[model samples]
Target: MTQSATRSGAPERVGRFELLVPIGTGGMATVYLARTRLIADTYRYAALKILHQKLAADDGAGLADLVAEAKLASAIRHPNVVPVLSVEEDEPWVALVMEYIEGETISGLIRAARAKGERIPQPIVGAMIADVLAGLHAAHEATDGGKRLDLVHRDVSPQNVIVGLDGRSRLTDFGIAKIDRTNATATGLVKGKTGYMAPEQIAGLKLTRAVDIWASAVVTWELLAGERLFHGEPMPTMLRIVNEIPARLRTIEPSIPESVDEAVAQALAHDPSKRPATADAFRKILVDAWGNLADPAEVGRYVQALSGEKLDRRRAQTEEILDLRARMTTVTRHAEASARDTSSSKKAPGDLPTRLESGPTTAPGETGFASTGSLRRPGRTRALGLGIAALGVVAFGVWMVTRSGANVAASPTTPAREASSSEAASRIVVFSSKRPIVAVRVAGRTVESPPALTLGVPVPTGAHEAEVVAADGERASVSVPADASQVLVPLEPATSAIEPSASAGAAASARPTGRAPGRLQPPAKATAAPKDPGLAPPPY
Candidate 1:
């Protein structure tokens, strides 16, 4: 909750992580879209979950629980499990920096589908639940010093499962997970979403991994039926879960097969022993029932169809945040240079260093350089102005060199050695889109596009095809010679693909009109799919 302010008034950067924007505020912590200072000119984004000061102060054990969550998640490594990259134990706050899943939660997806007058397809639901079970099993099997940690994810609600565009479902948020020999969940205290809680869990009985199994079944039931399995206030819902007889899956939806219904019924059994022995067992049954229809590619296609426009906008916003990082660096360097110059100036003996309040003021929308009238002293002010002007000139030159259609060639009289070096240099291809957000493909492979791109990248000295695809599936492709380093990609508004036989009106009418819903202040670079940091890495 504390802001980092250097003497120079630069944007806050916590340790090596630069906080971009606040994306969420929850009961336990505030999540930020943040990036690491990996190396010079290289950064990776992550979700920075910082514990609220009030929560830490009010409940001393709350902070420990958050740290325990990070440690526990770090121990369980699996593709389906969201990873914790690092932890920060600094003053005024403690943070759990984790791999940010660049996708919507299952709850978000379900809401979107409902809004579209669509039910989540059964196969997709099966695949998603299967993924969650797989992750839970990994955690359950996690061991420390050759002894099983006996982990049980107490919270397995729709909100904790993220469905990536690649059709992968990742389980996140282990804050309330129960670990053996630890008072993480406490014996009698109830935790987790009411509708997803197991019957045993509501009774405050000693828990086992079966609680997670029951919760998963509840999620499956909800997904298949398109309604909560249990409803009403917390007490009413808990009572219903304990007393009322559960409905058969087929009763909610007739299309659901009997085998699937039987499997879910067993998973949602009142007694923990009656439930499936393990998460893997439940997953196998669901996978078999769903069959080949639960293909990842199909699920991926469904997700892309629903979220393409939002993803495009998200990628653009990510680029802008990265761009801001560079600007922040520039401002920091400029401030330091001004400070140094002020310090080294000829001054009276025993005088204090000249203190410049607010450092330098920048013109509206202009970064890196400052406007006139920042410093009061004539000589020092002129020097600062000159330095800023020189930076401006360099920036202008860079812009000109990177602009689309700009060409530069070696002189015919250039030395042979220099010519070889130029040939060896990696050719860059800058992909530009006329539309604010468009996906660009190079050689049929998806690539990240920069925001407000002007410079074109150099390509291998041969002919290459560049494709610009809109969120609506409208695409345009162009061929360019390898020798031509820079090319402008004109991306028009998504229109119907022209078919040789069908009329343009027919094509237009066939196209989907559903635009992916806009975000309510979403994260730009929520890092997921990060390289596994070993059991121990340097804490932030």
Candidate 2:
């Protein structure tokens, strides 16, 4: 890994996959460019989506939603849909391993075209939407045990459709999809993008496969017109979808064929019964109207024309990660052997289970993870702990390489002892203050304060200097105790010329507390006059 990569705090590995770089971040998870070794000198690249640590710890619903997404998406088998290879749950991390696509999202394509003052070709638009529709149709008609699953992909937009350089357009991100038997989405909760939602969906009516058709039509219209079909705030956008009539596609772009325009308009009909009954039927109609639908090869060429530089950069990054792996194989092997010895000889009572025990392969239902009673399967061992141990070993090796001048091949015999002591003795310094912190600088690194006011920085067992910056631009320097796990900083009011109170300053001087890291304690309600009234107090 490069120095910049290290500064970004990217992990070396998560579970069995080595993380290459971050690809994308969403509301509840982050997707990484990752690879796993298949055999000696052979590997498979993947887009690994891991749930956010904060969300996993605080919200059961977030974890349940991801589990539901993995289960539903993994069931569909289609060339036009991205495949989910596996779902992994190791404490502090739950990830979905997916086939990586090297290309741009339709959203990116649209933005690039708009910036260049060009509209996407009608045939390309037709072919891409047709491909998406095929995937949606397969999902809608999917079955388990010879019974229809009755799936509805509630979130279908340009952002969720990825167009690979290989000329294939695949539908992705089933995070908000609804399965009739599962009820993954809660009642009365609106989940999809406002601009692409169908009228019934915005109104909280029971959804059907037609919602996907409606969203696909909106994407088609945007591709041809180079503007959003519905543009406004959430409430107004919903109202426009429900009560307004969209102008004909040919009105915005007269070059578009009248037949194509009519087909898209029909699909955009507000009444579910008025739209095409199925995604496949809508696809066939659009393709026939297009008359000369571009093949995947042509679509791939167009995508490359718009995003060749980005694709090249991504390819280089992947190569670099692979090269780094090749160079570190010897060190990785040594670390793994050391971890195995440690695991066998010194078993800690609280250590995470070494494997995920497999039981029945049941589908996720209404209660999500609860329906399965646990995230783990009941019987057969799957070596999850081995993956975790490998991650820790790699982490220890990387730390050594960073500290000892990057001679990765040196010190084959040192990891076993160093890993034990360094891993055990490492302590976290949790910084807290009564004022809103903007950022914290420690050990030559500065990190913005998270939503939680408390910032925990892990350090070697030694005294360190911490600089805290408040939202009001007041700065304080404090010496953190080598042994103290928690410390409180003091800050004076922005308007005050006086320094912080003596008692507060005394508290700031290396106060130790038994509070656990990453747990937010409730804050007392403030009754005094507020200076930065717009900013809410951190939930501790």
lDDT, each prediction: 0.63, 0.67
Q: After superposition, how far is residue 45 of candidate 1 from its true place, in Å?
A: 2.4
Candidate 1 TM-score versus the reference = 0.61
Tens digits of per-residue lDDT, candidate 2, 1-540, equal 001110012245677877665566666677877778888967778888877655676747778888888888978999999999998665566789999988889998997788678888878888889899999898998777788888888889998999987788899999878844443344444888889999988877888998999999999999899998898888888888899988898889899988888989999998899999999999999888888988889999999899875554444334433444453565568666866655565544455655554456456674364333334421112245555666677777655533332212211212234445654455445554434444465654443422222444545577666776655455667666564444445442243222212121222223233433332222212222112213221110
Q: Every model's Cα RMSD, please? A: 18.2, 20.7
**For candidate 2, which ten residues in a row score worst on lDDT?**
1-10
Stretches of candidate 1 off by over 4 Å are 1-11, 179-189, 322-540
Q: Give the per-residue lDDT digits (tens) of candidate 1, residues 1-540.
A: 111211010123556776654444555666666778777866777888877555677758778888889888999999999899888765555778888766678887887788788889988888899999999999899887788988889889998888876789999889889855443343344778788888877887787899999988988999998988888898889899999878998988999988899999999889889888999988998888777556778888888777655454445434434443344345446646665665565355555546544555677667756675443454555566666665565455434332311211111122324224444344544443333322344442333222222223334555666654433334556555444333334443233321111111222223332333321111122111222223221122
Clashes of each: 10, 2
* Candidate 1 residue-wise lDDT at 515: 33
